[model samples]
Target: MIILYHPRATRPRSRRLPLAVLALAAALEGKEQYEIVDGNLEDDPTARILELIARHKIELLGVSAMPGPQMVAAMETSREIRRLHPHVPICWGGYFPSIYPDAALNARYVDFVVRGQGEDTLLELLDALRGNRSLDSVKGLSYKDMFGLRHDNGERPMKGPDEFPWSPFHRLPVEKYLGPSFFGKRTAVHHASIGCPFNCSFCGVHAAYGNKEKMESPERTVAILTHLVECYGADSVQFYDMNFFLREDHARELCDRMAHLNLRWWCEARVDIMSRYSDETFAAIKRAGCAMIFFGAESGSDWVLEEMQKGITTQQTLEIARRTRQFGIIPEFSFVIGNPNDPDRDTRETLRFIRKIKRINPDSEIIIQHYTPTPQPHDAGGEMYGKIEVPFPDSPAGWAAKEWMNFTLRIDTNAPWLKRRTKKLIDNFEIVVGSRWPTVQDIRAPRWSRIFLQVLSAWRYALHFYNFPFELHLANQFISLRKPKRESL
Candidate 1:
């Protein structure tokens, strides 16, 4: 049995941990030999997949889809597999499918979809398939019958984080999949837990994992870290948790354990959580080789923050940024633009907030992203649900394609404006700094090339500041923009 993990794009690095976790579980169960075939790792995996299916007489294929363009690719892959190997069972599992099982099951090509945590459920399904047993008894699965009727087994209780196997990083081509930025260094990605306690309107956290946050036991987290550093020789570990600091003591214990090992790591945490952590805890995290932290400061406007249910004020965000910088941890912040309720004034305010953050930490990086209305299960009850236009398709794969295309087109259309505004804003900042610092030309680009220079500078900054490959794709769209030519149908 082969488990093919299809990435959302041509780059397979970001989804490494998820794929590793799934593969590791399959290996541990001793059910069947599992291998990860990343679609994005090489040229399209279509031909290779056909070869593998025929050579191995593969019986089961699993595709992971996130909410965007990748889902479309997954759908296309499933359809292709069904066409070539009708006897094989193809499954879809990931953030989008887990939240919207109906949308996934409704797709003609998808035989099954798994919601929430998939490790145990997936293993069970694979075992049943090997024995040719009925799938109705499988927990945490949604499947369709020959009559085209969908049957949902309903979600099982959330799995404890400790129950999950350590990621099977060793199974993948580690060096080949590492991001360009970390090419020279050995990096491992892991998650300390699943779910978020907050109920952000535009976020799918609560929908994917219930409102309750789960923390991996300190021992389990330490064991993974130990394996990465001692076994894999990982120099840096990145935590992909929704909120790394939700359980303060758990975070502190993890930090304390990490401090015993010489490993550099990074994690995402909420501004409010950072502000509330004791000085000793912050010190412990820094001592634990935490080189950087990314905060989801979605907006600088209190109104926008409230609208998003971010549960953090603008002042709180600023304070956290200052304090984080004081602790000598790289404070990477992100903000959302084109907010649904944002007028011209609100947009300007967000840009001004970026300037403020730069002033506070001259070396800090601010990632500016356009707001996207992603629908969640709970979105139906949100105030913005009906008002905000979500462009996602009904099927997981279709939605993925729409998201990728939308993001591509949006960046292409907004490139000139982004370039112009970024230059204007930077020049204005230089003027403010020039009053106090005589060597301020060092801060500003020449007026003639400021726009292009700013665009380049923003791209360079975004490589490390944002999800590199995703931003690279968005940048490519901006660089490729040309007036469209009319075509006849």
Candidate 2:
């Protein structure tokens, strides 16, 4: 028996489908006896995993992990499993291991790190364990040999979604994952594409899946979503595609079919690419229930954009803001503050630009993140890699440390280049803007509290005084405003 574990990454209310583990399970379907145990649903995931191992003759334990809180939970659970069941092999796959394979392998509990895409790699690894193939033959694998020497078996070429079997939704408690969101009452999530074509410096998509993206056919995509709608009563969907909008024809065709499903959806797209989309396509998208588009408007300065190797220009971001408003779809602009060269100027310019965006489109949502560097090839991250002063931790335990956890979440990154004053300014501004325009995604905040926050923060916003919004901060303690970046799974 094989066990696939999805460590708790978000709150139960914020949990979506564990697509990563589901993808791995899809490969093992019919051929292997396996079960998926989601940590989000369990109060004591480690005990549950140990119970399963004790009950069944488990061959391997596969874990899907991400950065931040998930890594911490995964480490603790894996450590306990190793101590209790010394014979059971533990393997980790996902962004955490893909980005830092060596660090993942550094943990004595983790016997293997399936880097990059894991569907094929995992199956091969299982075969090797059964003596059907040599361990060295498994591409996209990092593992310690019998002599305790680590070896990386290089990268595997990414495959189209069509190449793999559909996710075994029947194996999951589908209703538990269907939750309320800004889109609809019962919202579902789907990843219709594999990887992203663009190679943004700050993003880990390129490192995980390379710059090549293969999308499922619109027919197959619509079919799967139709199943979710008809069988599971999913009224809305949010595509987890790294880059959802690629080709105009693909968008138009997908939208054409999606119009019949009646799903109010949200997705991430490139500002430059969407800028070139036709007005007819935009109308089709809106008609098909495209409520919001999350664009990576990383910085306001053109030089910073070039430095990050972001192909979109500041002008394109502004133009898209205007265009998205015309279509009545909200454009959620996310900015990465604190550039390596000059953080203060970057923060100031980006804040000013965010204000401009709000002025142009009152419904536009702004998400602010500190610039935290990830492990990437120098060329992929541009010259910014050389500018980072702090070295990344060499082990999973070190990464699970409090400061590094904050760094992973990009919440309170104490990077060498960032000043405390600058971080304070960003926080104060975030509070003011978030209060001034309470997020529509926030279903938890009471209507009265939203009105109260807006009324309280109006003067500060109008006066352009973002410093020390103590009242708003204090109000938030009671309101507990939901940040979509953190809440949205």
Candidate 3:
């Protein structure tokens, strides 16, 4: 038996499909007995995973991870696994591994790495383990021979979306991954496309998947979506496309197919796509079950956008937001505030633009994150990485360590008044990073007012609950009521 995993984050509470690992499992289905462990959703995940490995007599473990905090957690899990069982092979795949394969393979905790797409490479690695097959046969793989010189088979072919089979949905922990959805319990994440052609300076995608874009046939997309709705009773979907509208005609055709699925879905796209597509197409998108769309309108300052090589102007972004709202689709944006040129000025401009957006469209949602200046080697040019005196992290371990060290610029606002306030009010208290600003709901408030707030919350929940079809809504409640008793009794 084999075990594939999505390692836990620093402290993960939300789960999603470990798509890469599950894809491998799908390919090896009839050949092996395998189970996927999602550390994010499972309790005491590392311990549970260790227990499962021992019980199943598992020989190899695979983990797929992105960079940043998730990579840190993955290393923590793998280090623990290696400490207890040194002989078991632990393979690394996904974002950090693909871009920094040599560094990943050199790490004490990682025995092997599968770069690019892992489906075929991983299966071949398993074949090598089963019989004494030479590792040299596998493409897009990196590892050290007994002599300890690393070999990376640099020539790997790219495969299209149609080449891989559908996701093994039965292995997913669906209900446990419940995200914020207005109309459903089971949230299905589907993708109609893979890869993006954009060269935004800060993005690592161009390195991971390369610049060529591919779209799954609209028929393939509809079939996958239908399985989610018919098999799991999913009322909502989150499309995992990097740029959902890379090709305007295909996007419209995709939306046309989506209209009959009876699913409420959301997707991410660039602002340039909004201007590129006609208003009627957006109306078609909204009618075809897309209630919300997220745009990467990173900064309100044109200079920062230009610095980031984002390619779109502030006027273009604002106009895109206006058009999105005009079509009755909720417009959401992802923003980054701190950059070198004028950190405080940039943040203020962002807040001003968000305030303006809210004034025009009160329900629009925006998330603003403080920028950390650590550069990615893949996206780093001499103009950016070389010009800065701060050294780039040479290894994944160094990158993880640098996150806590003073190498990157954090808290860039050096204003005296703000510093005093940060020390006195914010820093003195543990304000969680990226948490929503709190509103007043004091326990000391008068009893009647507290009661009113409780009633208001109930009213809001009721509104969300009533959004679904009556029969489907009743079925969900019935299932929920039965689920607890079956377990408790």
Residue 22 in candidate 1 has what lDDT? Answer: 50
TM-score of 3: 0.77
lDDT of 2 by residue, 285-381 (tens): 9999999999999999998998888888999999999999999999899988889789899999999999999989999998888887776622322
> Over 4 Å off in model 2, which ranges?
377-383
Clashes of each: 5, 0, 0
For residue 382, give model 3's deviation from the true position in Å.
9.8
lDDT of each: 0.64, 0.89, 0.65
Supply the global lDDT for candidate 1.
Answer: 0.64
**Superposition error at 56 for model 1 (Å):** 3.3
Q: List the residue pairs that clash in candidate 3.
A: none
Please say which candidate is ahead in TM-score: 2 or 3.
2
Best by lDDT: 2
RMSD of each: 7.9, 1.7, 9.7
lDDT string for model 3 (251-330, tens) is: 88888988988777778888877777887788889888887777888888888888888888887778777887788877
For residue 383, model 3's alpha carbon misses the true position, in angstroms, by 8.0
Better model by TM-score: candidate 1 vs candidate 2: 2
Top-scoring candidate (TM-score): 2
Worst window of 10 by summed lDDT in candidate 1: 480-489
Q: Candidate 1: where is the Cα deviation over 4 Å?
A: 8-28, 42-44, 127-134, 178-184, 378-386, 389-391, 400-404, 407-489
